[model samples]
Target: MIAARSLFRAGAAGVMALCVALAVPAVAGAQPYPSKAIQIVTSVGPGSNFDQLGRVFAERLRQKLGVPVVLENATGGQGLVATRRVLNAKSDGYTLLLTSSGLATMPAIVKNAGYKAEDFVAVAPLGQVPFILYASSSVPATDIASFMSYLKSNAANLNMGLLTTSHITTMLARKFGKVVGGELVEIGYRSSPETLSALLANDIQMVATTHAIAGQHVALGKIKAIGVVADERTQAVPDLPTFKEMGYPTLVINVWEALFAKADVPKDVLDKIRAVSREIVSDPSYLTAMVPTGMEPWRIPFDSLQSVIDEEAKAFKKDADELKISFD
Candidate 1:
């Protein structure tokens, strides 16, 4: 009888030990994550253009997430700081980064940028701005025809003001200049705002920038928009004809800004973020608020974001090599 009782006790202890081991892991896996505030990092400063746009989405995300969405500015190096931070964040969904087209363009513009084209997966394309070619009012060109004519006789006197050579803005501008045999003089600014300022001062003959950046100046008659370099004429400035309309598609370049998270993030987290992003953009108020700022969310446009990332990175790599754009 004693032997049988000892055997029963041993069997019970084994079963109990197995149950504890399984339950411990199950409980840990079930723990809720992101039970606290979240963060959205931007490469632009407070009150800046990005900050204004980011704030709108941040507020919207807060409503959907039931968690505070904090906006942090990690400016300079053309958004490299913010990108690195996102890559280094813990594998939790609490951190996200709001970035511009530069997220894809910077690696090409800066040498040894330590990131490749496929580094960040796109959560969603948040917004887009059409790029326009503007000339200092000092230049006598008023239309595309006059602009071409002026380029013919005054090649030596012309200079192009650019924020950075790695930008799609300058790449498209360069190709257009080459096709027309203009070979414009190029000047670089530290930032887009600085480039716009130089254009108003007539520091250069022409500038390639977005609609909203130079819209106020154009309205004030301080600068003249020579052409729209985007796929279509923006509704905000319907009068400016697109490059395709002008019979030259090389000038078509739209600045697409999107949200990116590290590629290694969990699928459930990515899905949650993607769903929230799509919902936020679809909000009617978001459309109304963003349009006036010269931004538009593409409406169900077919974007295989993975493919877009690959293509942008390849194009930049090629441009950097061909133009010899490098930091070291």
Candidate 2:
């Protein structure tokens, strides 16, 4: 009888051990989201306004999310590579895309952007960086009026440097040429810094670039800002008037940086991210850091992001169609 009882007790212990082993996987799988590091991808290279803004926000997000936030610069295919990378990544909110207003122009210009603006869910806005039309010091112009006249006179020989064909700056540059009644030859460069360098070297007569990229050159009188492409003049270049104010109201284009995740990312995870983003953008330190970069805090509410993207994409498509611009 004692031997039989010992065998039954040992069998019961074995059953309990098996049950615990079976439960371990379930417990591990149920752990909260973001158990690992998150990556933010952008098409721009390092030291860009996008990179600077993204890095600052990433640090704050890391602090808030209690996980490492890594920034990866994919930089190719006119942002198609980075866009597709985030689009194809797992929809667990671990991978994200940090992009600019130029994203809206992708579908309008690129025949196969692989994803539409709506395919990604908007997480948060970083800031708005206004585009400024800049001319090399070699150009015989100081302001928009004089610049237009000079462009008309030198239209046959002038070249306008474009950062990328799909960028808003390119669209604005094309439009500016049309408005000035001149076909400024388009020269493409790999990055804003490169574009600005070409402008400074007089390789290109004009370029529409961000103040962050061209402000120092303007300060040293190496290049002159013709006009801003925002709705209003920016404090960073208070003396410079906007294109709108300069009688070209249709030339306004403001580049905004924002975060996006795969559209199917779990709503709960997105909610957590948006909440933290709201906190970070509102922080005083964050605002102060962006000032010198000519970025202004411009937050789009979580719910309004899709409509804004849709509207912007539609507008860009219309413009591209009118301009007969297409990469394909």
Candidate 3:
């Protein structure tokens, strides 16, 4: 009996040791969130505004998080490829998406977007870039009023260039056409540069594109900016008046870029990211680098970020329905 009791005690001691050894690894694995590198997948390629902003954001994230932050440019599919890639990633907050306002229009246009704008929770807003209505120098319009008159008189002959049918600029262009009572022909191009090139060659009478792309040409007298599609005049072109200021309030639209993560990512992780993002956007150095790119700092409150995205998504869907616009 004494020998059996001693053996039982030894067995219990061994079992306890084994249990503790197993628990040790579990404890170590639970190390605070973000123990590994984070990847930011941008929806655009290098040299694009989205790519440039994403790189700067990644650098800032690395500085704050003390972890390697990688930026992957996953272009193509009209921003759907990168959007789906981030959506399919593990909901651990390690894989993030950096996309533009085009996200809001995906569901409205693409038949198999496979995701909605609200599917990903917004982590931070990068900035808002105003859209400019640029006209080829050959056109007889210098300002908004005269442009409206010219558009009405030459609606049958004038052609408007678009980067893509699904781009936000497409909706703005359509709205502009409605406001001016002209069925302006929209010619879709593969890219903004191509669209602008068409305008430069006088292949298209007008183009609605971001200020960043058209600002230089306008400054050099290559094209004329008829009006800006913003709530107010942008610092990039203070002399240019907004469509709203010229009496077209419905044309006030701006494209915004933002960071987003999977919706199911833990609240704590989202909070941490939002906190760091707020810090980065508010940094003077970040503003100095971004402002010259014709992007205005847009700091949507953390709590209001998702709501804003939802609203934009709804608005885009409404616009698409009204315009009968669909890619598929």
Candidate 4:
């Protein structure tokens, strides 16, 4: 009886030791984790490029983190409404904000944009897309030089259309107008659909929008791409030279998307997230899913200890000096 009791005690001890041994990795994994669902907040709508990139990141992160991801959209204020939601959420890894160049331009457009570029850190660079200079074939300008000339000659007569009043389009249009010494009749539409419909109906003479929005139209010969707004040409439209190559340099800006979480996540957690981000963004499966939808995956990683909040710190610094945006 004594021997049996001793054996039973030994077996129990061994089992407890095994459990403890197994628990170390389990606990470690849990430590680096989000044990709950993750939230990805974006301002772009369901079919927009930014929204698509945000969803792709969420899906990939969900797979790597072993948790479901929920994408919440706030859809306006040039992406601030959605981004602010993430910034205000608890700084835990569970919530991430997806953003584009508007992070650099929002402070100029709205008062109390609530957060700045320093507010969040970059997890990955989703991809880059070139803005196309598209115009209805119904208009007479067939090329970049001619387009500028026509705009200059018919400044009061020509109308330009894009996504929003406070968007990069406005700034670009202003720059273009300044370069050519002319004023554009700017039509600020909320979405590409309305913008395209108006252009198709000859309601607008020109549009500076995405190839995704304009590609189908361009292919159908409904519109012509006179120039690209990127520094380099795109694979889809290699023959189209950038505005810089045609003499306008600063106009060459590629739209980009980046992943960001709160500024105060743990170092290890950030490293893990970065690792997963690199894997996810570079994974061919992710690219396959994104490319068909017009999103190109590019990974630009950041360490957790790094300064996402530092980027937010100077919210006012990136504001354009000429911008006179008023909340009231």
Which candidate's lDDT is highest?
Answer: 3
| TM per candidate | 0.88, 0.86, 0.92, 0.81
Candidates in descending lDDT order = 3, 2, 1, 4
Candidate 3: clashing pairs of residues: none
Please give, for residues 1-328, the per-residue lDDT of candidate 2 as tens digits: 9999999999999999999999999987886867899999997788877788889999999999899999999988888889999888899999999988767668778887788877887789888877788988888888888887777788878888886634676687668777877677989887777888898889998888878778888889899988988887776778889879878888888678899889899999998899899899988999998876567777677679768877888888898888777786
- Across 1-328, the per-residue lDDT of candidate 3 in tens digits comes to 9999999999999999999999999988796767899999988878877678778889999999999999998888888889999989999999999988777668888898899766787889988777788999999889999988888788879889887634676777788778877777888898888998999999998987888887788889989999888876777778889889878888867678899889899999998999999999989999988865557778578679778878877887888898777775
Q: Candidate 4 lDDT, tens digit per residue, 1-328?
A: 9999999999999999999999998877765377788877877788777787777778878888898989887787677787778878887778877777676557555678787656666676777677888887777887888887887788778788867734667666666776778777888898888888888888998887777777888878888888988767766677888889988876654477776777687667666778888787777887778776665544344442234324532433343444332331
The TM-score leader among the candidates is 3
Q: Give the residue spans of candidate 2 off by over 4 A.
A: 1-28, 152-154, 292-294
Model 1, 126-159: lDDT tens digits are 7776778898988888988788778778876888
Give Cα distance to truth, residue 133, candidate 3, Å.
0.7
Off by over 4 Å in 1: 1-5, 8-29, 164-166, 300-303
Q: How many residue pairs clash in each candidate?
A: 0, 0, 0, 9
Global Cα RMSD, each model? 2.7, 4.5, 2.2, 6.9
Cα displacement (angstroms), candidate 2, residue 65, comes to 1.2
Give the lDDT of residue 105 in candidate 3: 66
Query: Which residue pairs clash within candidate 4?
Result: 117-311, 117-312, 118-308, 118-311, 118-312, 119-312, 125-298, 125-300, 126-298
lDDT of each: 0.76, 0.83, 0.84, 0.73
